[model samples]
Target: MPLKHRFRTDAALGLVQVSPPLIYALVMLAAPLGTIVLFSFWTQDFLTIDRSFTLNNYREAVTDPLYSELLFRSLRIAGAVTAATVLLAFPIAYFVSFQVRPARKSLWLFLITIPFWTSYLIRVFLWRVILAYDGPVNGTLISLGIIDEPLSWILYNANAVVITLAHAFAPFAILPIFVSLEKIDRSLLEAARDLGESRTATFFRVTLPLAMPGVLAAILIVFIPTIGDYVTPRLVGGSGGTMIANMIQTQFMRLNNAPMGATLAVIAMLSVTLISLVLVLATRRWTRSR
Candidate 1:
């Protein structure tokens, strides 16, 4: 066969391999995104939608102080949850990666993943029960005489939202960090220690740098999804805990303003994309520098 013909055949084969995933994305992901973008520029009222193009939705979604405030608040909450999840997951991941007996590692990992077997809504409600006035947390504290009354602060608040979300996202943070930690070459740590480095120094200089990619992955996975989590905020977040997703929900459902809701969704999605890009770039540079 001529060289050009061979190259064309290979290219066609590559396209064939990619076509299924490309078509799946086009149908499932791209279609919904396109619809949202279209709706965002339109108008809606009383179960009626005007497909006519306009920037009014974007104008209100952006210029409205309420939308901006909620967007920032959502970012903050998502940031906090990301930090907490990564910090808490790191040690457990480290323990599993470096300390667990090889035979027991699977068991430990499986146990950690057990929470995923339950429905997400069920887990949220379980947190509600645990944090309720008469729940185990307050009851235990009161029985131990640690507090005079059931603490009202634990349930239906921003802190509750954070705690619940962090717990819910713990496994996501763990699995990635564990994969990263597990991939580190053990010989590198040994080499660092041979140069008279303390265990702590070796870990900081060798292990942590190698594991940073996983840490970044964990951050993006947890932060992005949690930022747009309407259910958690609605269930656990009282007025003080309402995130941008809750606002979007109110706009779409309660207000029957689909255009504004789609606009808000687009804004939220763009914010997450921007933040994730920054994180990836920053972490990539940091990893290379190390």
Candidate 2:
């Protein structure tokens, strides 16, 4: 074949290979997203969906005190969940990566994923039971003389949501950090020690920096989904623990305001995108500076 013809043939073959997924993405993801965007600009009146474009939905989503409160509450809960999950996950990942025998590392990872064997709803319900007023946690605390009675604050509140979400997303945080830690070269730590750096200093200067990619990945994974979670919040979070997702759900299902629901969905998506971008840039700058 002529050189140009051969190049064209290879390009055509590549396009053919990529076409299926491209079409699938457009049909599945893009189509629904486009519909949501279109719906967000319209207005809904109980049973009627006005197709006319309007900013009233966006205006209400932004200006309404209820919406603002729920949005902020969701952000706070997601932040708490992300912080708790990542902090708890790092040490476990570090131990598994460094302390566990190579032959047993797979076993540790397998154990970490055992939670996935059960339905997510089941786990959330189990947490609900464990955190109930008469549940094991309060029972143990009372028996140990830690409290006088069952704690009402732990269940059907933000605390319960945080605890459940952190536990649920623990594996998501651990795996990425483990992958990052595994990629780190042991020689760098040895060199740092040879130069008289203390254990803590070496970890801060060398280990943490290298593992940052995985940490950042874990952060995005846990933070994004937790913010949009309605089920756990609804099950464990009373009115006090209700997040934006619950509001979105109520708008669509109970209130029959599809436009308002879409509006809230768009706002939540944009906020998540902005926060994720900021995190990525900040991590990149910090890594480069180090």
Candidate 3:
């Protein structure tokens, strides 16, 4: 074959290989998202979609006190969970990446992931037992003379929801942070140390900035899912812990408002997407500057 013909053939084959993934993305992801976007704007009559575009849903979602309250609550709780996860996961990831041998690091990673093999519902329910008024936590506290009576505030509240979600998401934070920490060149830390930097200064100047990408990724992973979580809130949130997701559920199943439910979902999705984008841009800028 002539050189020009060979180049054309290779380009054609490349296009053919790429087409499958593009088609799959359109069908699996784009199609469902398109439907959600349409449904967000469509009006509904007693659970039936009327196929009429209206701003009524958005108006209600943004203006109504009930939904607005739920949205703010969800945002606050998700924010707290994100902050807690980052603070807690960073040290574990640092230790695993920098301190442990490679073989033992793999073992620790395996241990972190192994718990996920069990049913998530079961694991969450287990927390209920542990956090209950008459549970081991209270029992141990009483035995240790920390409290005379069982703490009623320990279960079925916002605190419970945050704790449960944080535990669930800790591994997500750890893995990304660990990967980023591991990828950092050891020479960077050594150079900082050789410059007469103390351990704390070296960590702040050399380690933390390099690990920010992983921290950003972990925040995105935890915050997005925790914001949309229905099971944890319903299981342990009680009245105070009711998130926007619970409101969406009520709209769909009990109130028979599919359009409104979908609208809330879309709004939540857009919020998460915006946050993720901001983090990505910030991380890119930080990486480039560093």
Best by lDDT: 2
Candidate 2 overall Cα lDDT vs. reference?
0.96
Which pairs of residues collide in candidate 2?
none
The TM-scores of all predictions, comma-separated, are 0.95, 0.97, 0.93
Report the C-alpha lDDT of model 3 over 170-225, residue by residue, as the tens digit: 99999999999998999989999999999999898789888887888899999988
lDDT of 3 at 141: 99
The C-alpha lDDT values of all candidates are: 0.93, 0.96, 0.90
Which residue pairs show backbone clashes in model 3?
A: none
Candidate 2 wrong stretches, greater than 4 Å: 1-9
Kindly give the number of clashing pairs for every candidate.
0, 0, 0
On TM-score, the stronger of 1 and 3 is: 1
Q: Evaluate model 2: give its TM-score.
A: 0.97
RMSD to true structure for each model, in Å: 1.9, 1.7, 2.3
Task: Determine which window of 10 residues in candidate 3 has minimal summed lDDT.
Answer: 3-12
**Model 3 off-target regions past 4 Å?**
1-11, 284-290
- Kindly state the number of residue pairs that clash in model 3: 0
